[model samples]
Target: MTATTTTAPTAASDSGLTYVDPRAPRFGQAITATVLTAGVVLAEPLFIYAIAAILGMALLSGWRLDLYGFSWRTVMIPLVGPPERREPAAPHRFAKLMGAGFTVLASALLLAGVPLAAYLLAGMVAVLAGVAATTGLCIGCRMYQQVSFFRRLGVV
Candidate 1:
């Protein structure tokens, strides 16, 4: 696909209108996968700190984009060239919410001393991230769409 650079941190969509970097969430997902992997393997119960950071970044990107631009995606844009490929931000925001909710619950479980449940929850997040990072299948986005479909069908 052809690409073009813009002065803005993100780029326009298929019609060249406002949108977000398709790769930003992928990069974030990879980082997320690594973080969750660490939490699972080390048994340090560090989910609160790490997941809180991810949730904060996700919130920033979803609600406070001026701050979101400070994230790694923006930092790497110069080396990677402006992100000309774009997608709707709504689904990504939904995905982030899902991830945040999962991590928060995982953190709470870790605190409650339910180690098995905590690891399983965190493992789900890691698998979701791994799917996005490796296969580009965003389970969260799929779930968002599914929910939207059900809502439209008056079955939600």
Candidate 2:
């Protein structure tokens, strides 16, 4: 007589998908951020454009464009938690990095007396992010990989 062995699969293996796909989270964050940013643009009285841009970056980065909280529990509540599989792609690290960078840049510009530039950059970032969300492409992630490859060769 022989006994059979049974093993439980881990969540990562159970998902039957890679942990990082570089598109899904970015798309979800983008959509969530855009809606909130649009509200901010409409309600805020000053630096509307610049604020909008900064908010746009927040949307792209999966961070709260608002200066309130910075936890996944907080960020994910309204952004990606509900409707669990709306976007199937795993969040790309590169997209998150770029989104954070853009958000910071826009914020600095807003504070540095370059509201127009901030606004424009933010608008462009938002538009590109929106397009990517709709079309399932991540320009930021592609650019990051390209730059990383060159940097490894000391070419910057």
Candidate 3:
């Protein structure tokens, strides 16, 4: 008789765990980003505390914890995992890019003591992000596509 060997598969080796649909709304990421932005705007330290609290809870629980596909393992446990994979949501990409730009510009203005410009830009970004979060319609995405189209036709 030939010797036989059996192996058991664990969640660690599961393929299903590695797949995430890109078209799916990243509700957790959106929510977390929104909250963080709001906190930054308000100059609140509680936001950081909240993140720490959530992470602490996850660590104590030993259960899988994810925020917008970002795992607690990545955030705290120092465990390496597959990179986050999600469908490319054009609107989100546009909003994120523009929002980041606006944030940087606003910060520069603030550092330069240009209160009006800084506040105005920050307000605009907050409003746009808020509207996109609430309505699922991203003005930045439309603006980016419009610019892209115009540029392609040499319309500036």
| Predicted structure with the largest lDDT when compared to the true one | 1
Model 3: residues with Cα > 4 Å off, grouped in runs: 1-88, 151-156
What lDDT tens digits, residue by residue, belong to model 3 across residues 10-98? 11323333222232223433554565466467854455335334433433343234233243223322343322443334444454556
Collision pairs in model 2: none
TM of each candidate vs. truth: 0.81, 0.51, 0.48
Model 2 clash tally? Answer: 0
Residues 73-111 of candidate 1 have per-residue lDDT tens digits of: 447676777666678766776787888888888888888
Q: Could you give the candidate ranking by TM-score, starting with the highest? A: 1, 2, 3
Name model 1 segments beyond 4 Å from true. 1-6, 11-18, 60-62, 65-69
Ranking 1 against 3 by lDDT, winner: 1
Deviation from native of the Cα of residue 118 in model 2, angstroms: 1.1
lDDT of each: 0.72, 0.49, 0.47
